[model samples]
Target: MQHQPDFSPAADRNKQPILDMLLRVLAPQGSALEIASGTGQHAAWFAAGLPGWAWQPTEVQPEALASILAWTRSQGLANVRPPMLLDVASPDSWPADAQFDLVYCANLIHIAPWPVCAALMRASARLLAARGKLITYGPYLESDIATSEGNIAFDASLKQRNPAWGLRALDEVAQEAASAGLRLAGRHALPANNLLLVWERAEH
Candidate 1:
């Protein structure tokens, strides 16, 4: 018998940068809920990096769950919780009973429909603690900045694959966040023309 874990070259390349930024932005004491934990690579890597951070990984696709488990086992990370089944498009699929200090979703919006984008914002808001943050990473169309040539091509490819799947405008995403009782906390320019938009749960 042979064992092979799912692989993603892009995830491999960007995980380090994302983890580095997370280290700088987050406190050492916080829990994380990772949505769309494809291949489980990021959760494994990040949990190991932020040893104090408890990480719960989730995915909508059943096929991806195996990979996540494989990576987590390989990393021997004690802080990582078992992966959960979560579909952002379906409100019932989200863990209504759970809350965390961080909601991390990467490369999910551009591939999902617009409604899922709104759903994601609302779901993140619901899952966050008072000062918890929802951090999304992906290429986005910015009203102020010119879209990079690579991102432009990537966006076209995504839309061609599925009319509803394409890079979302930053303003639109921000608006949805606001509607979800989340406010823009910070934005970081990442490599490959991607952006990490951080939204914090509004303080009552």
Candidate 2:
């Protein structure tokens, strides 16, 4: 039997919207490192959309590499590199001597242990170029904004599945980035009540 790529309905639906935001925020040309490239849907979509960007997709699950490759290969996107094995929780799992203009991660922090969030910030800090940005997209809890009922329920269900997994507050996420010498540079509200946040080097 041939290997089949995993698909996410949500990713399929939201890829265009997310690409629209990326078009608005990203530079004309640069390198991008995508963390937790789940299902490889986003990697293919974004790589096709941002033709000038060289996209490197990484995932902790070795099994996921095939799916990522399948998707990107099907798209015939030369800009999308082969998927790499990466675990945000492991400091040594990141690519050595690599610096990307953008580190993009979507919908992973809320489903993983809290430590992964901190580790992501630290690793991103080390991998981003001086003027690079870390862009994260997902539903997040905010102290100032009223939480959507759907997000609240989603958060509850996540905690039910794993006590360590739940929606993280935006402020708390910012603090972790700050600890890693990054700062919240931009925040954009996207469809489905999700937020796309941009973090850049603190000194830059």
The best candidate in terms of lDDT: 2
What clash pairs does model 2 have?
A: none
Candidate 2 Cα errors over 4 Å, as ranges: none
Q: What TM-score quantifies how close candidate 2 is to the native fold?
A: 0.98
Q: What is the C-alpha lDDT of each candidate?
A: 0.91, 0.96
Question: How many backbone clashes are present in model 1?
Answer: 0
| RMSD, every candidate, angstroms | 1.2, 0.9
Write candidate 1's Cα lDDT for 77-116 as tens digits. 8999989999999999888698899999999999999998
lDDT of 1 at 170: 92
- Compared with the true structure, the alpha-carbon lDDT of candidate 1 equals 0.91
lDDT for residue 82 in candidate 2, whole number 0-100: 97
190 Cα displacement, candidate 1 (Å): 1.0
- Model 1 stretches astray by more than 4 angstroms: 1-3
lDDT of each residue in 17-92, candidate 2, tens digit only: 9999999999989999999998999999999999999999999999999999999999889999999999999988
